[model samples]
Target: MNIVLIGYRGTGKSTVGKVLASRLGRTLVSTDAEIVRRAGQTIPEIVAKLGWDYFRDLESTVCQELAMRDGLIIDTGGGAILRSQNVDSLKKTGTLFWLTASIQSIASRIGGDTQRPSLTGTKSFLEEIQEVLTERTPKYQAAADHVVSTDGQSITQIVDTIQSCL
Candidate 1:
């Protein structure tokens, strides 16, 4: 089975995914990175040129494709769960771990990242985080096989918790 990491951008999904994949000797596949690779553009660029719908379509395709593989550490984009089909596809042969952190923790972790475009174009950074997290929390909770909190935890600690859960 694959181990899938699902969470907000700043929740350390990418970082923990790397360590988990290394520790378990599994290939690490990030859906976001895959989308960028397949589209030949960064996320912000893709979103800017094609729109969020197009970006999400690419994300869903990546999720579906990765779901067919095994023994992988699949790190998904934050909005991957917005579509039920994506969640269903990912859960087919994967155990989903939802990583969560407080808004402050998330902001501090991703304050200066420009690779991803603003999810909400109008809100302040903190407000966008709060709004997006609030909206996605239920979807994350519903799709998750296990929930891991990243607040006050190192990447190692987070990976340890995930391993213990596994």
Candidate 2:
């Protein structure tokens, strides 16, 4: 089965996914990167030109494609689970781990990152994080086979926790 990591951005999904892939000798496929590749643009560019709906459609396609494979480490975009179809596709042959962190942790981790466009155009960065996390928590909770909190944990510790779960 595939090991899927889903979480808000800055929650360590990408970092943990790389280590998991290396440790397990599995291919690491990032849905966000795949979307960028398929669209021939960065995420912000895609969102700017088309909109979030278009980007999400691309994400769904990627999810469907990835789900057809096996033994992969999938690092999904933060919003991937917002659509039930994407969640369903991912869970077809994958065990999802929801990585979580406190808002403060997330803010610190991603404070300078510019690749991701603002999820809420009007809100401050912290406010956006809070609002988005509040909205997505339930979806993440429902879709997750396991929940891993990243606050105060090293990458090794987080990976060990997930490994133990598996």
Candidate 3:
């Protein structure tokens, strides 16, 4: 089985995934990075050029593919849980770990990142984080087998917590 990390942006999924994969001797696969590589564009570019719907379609495909693999530390895109099918697909072969952080912590972590496009273009960074997190919190909770807070936690601590869960 795989250890799948799913959560909002800036929640340390990718970073924690690396440590988890190393500790468990598993392969690391980041859906966002894979999407960028396959699309030949950055996330913002994909959203701008192909539109959010297209990007989401690609994410769905990635989610399906990731679900069929084994012994992987999968770092899912932040919005993967927005689509129920993606969550179900991933849950089939992986233990879902939802890495959570406060809106303030998420803003501090990724507020200035230029590569990611906002889901709600009308809102400010903090507003977007708060709104999106509020809307998606239930879905995340539903999809997770374990939830680990990344707020004020080191990479090792987060990894240790996840390992203990497994």
Best by lDDT: 2
How are the candidates ranked when ordered by TM-score, highest leading? 2, 1, 3
Better lDDT candidate (2, 3) = 2
Badly placed stretches (over 4 Å) of model 1 are none
Candidate 2 lDDT by residue in tens digits, 1-166? 9999999999999999999999999999999999998899999999999999999999999999999999999999999999999999999999999999999999999999999999999999999999999999999999999999999999999999999999
Clashes found in each candidate (C-alpha, N, C closer than 3 A): 0, 0, 0
lDDT of 2: 0.96
TM-score of each predicted structure versus truth: 0.99, 0.99, 0.98
Candidate 1, pairs of clashing residues:
none
lDDT of 3 by residue, 5-118 (tens): 999989999899998989999999999999999999999999998899999999999999989988899999989999999999999999999999988899899977898988
10 residues in a row with least lDDT, candidate 2:
33-42
lDDT: worst 10-residue window of model 3: 110-119
Q: Model 1, 7-111: lDDT tens per residue? A: 999999999999999999999999999999999999989999999999999999999999999999999999999999999998999999999999999999999
Considering lDDT, where higher is better, how would the candidates rank from best to worst?
2, 1, 3
TM-score, structure 1 vs. true: 0.99
Predicted structure 3: clash tally: 0
